[model samples]
Target: MSLSQQRRFPRRRTSVGASRDFVTGVLIEWQLHSLIEDIELCVSELATNALLHGAPPGREFSVGLHRVEELVRLEVRDSGPGQPVVQCPDDDACSGRGLRLVRALADDFGINDHIVGKTVWLVFKAPAAPAPAPAPLTTPGSS
Candidate 1:
């Protein structure tokens, strides 16, 4: 079965934490524990970017998660005009490395622009479920 959810948060510093918590709860509900760490990191980065560069004062940004089969897709939408580009910041730079980190962690990353905003998305392959334990060994004559 596929799962999907979305939430909108105001453009504020706290929204980044809220976004991470929201994503974490959803992944847990969907039994996607294996992806929690990477997903949370990505969500934090994207949400921070949205609050910093995309949403204007009093505006809001959104986060969405969709899981179909073995693929999980995450999207962060904001009222920004330009798409995010990956940049190799200097070793001492404290900022500008979010997208680069995302690119390294996610299987695929891209941006989709709408008439009014843009959505930065990351796609990840979910870890395979463990095999069910073999049925207890049975002897033909055993009860």
Candidate 2:
């Protein structure tokens, strides 16, 4: 099965959170509940990072989702400059753990440069199929 969805938002801190919630709702509506939390957090963190570092003023960002075969991908794009450097956030640092968390949760992830800004993508394995309904019980003397 394949599913795809996308949305764009202005580069703003509040928009990042709202976008996460919106995307999470979409995932749940599509019966991809298993991935809702993880993907939500990943998207939020990445978007927040983009807003903080990438978005300058009037730039915008986009989030795209693609379900191909047994894999689902979440991509966030922003109009900021320079690619994000995936580094280990120091213990004493106030921030910089966004990418680290993305790396930990996403099965496979990467950074891509776009004409305007950059896109950070994370791919996850689709959730297991729901078990089949059980057969009705039969009693020896019932029939």
* Clashes (N, CA, C under 3 Å) per candidate: 0, 0
Weakest lDDT window of 10 consecutive positions for candidate 1: 79-88
Task: Encode model 1's per-residue lDDT on 16-100: one tens digit a residue.
Answer: 9999999999999989999999999999999999988898787999999999889999999998777788999999998999999
> 85, model 1: CA deviation in Å?
1.1
**Which residue pairs clash in candidate 1?**
none
Those runs of model 2 whose alpha carbons end farther than 4 Å from true positions after fitting are 131-143
Worst 10 residues of 2 by lDDT: 22-31
Clashing pairs in 2: none
Query: Cα-based RMSD of the predictions, in order?
Result: 1.3, 2.5
Question: Mind sharing the TM-score for model 1?
Answer: 0.93
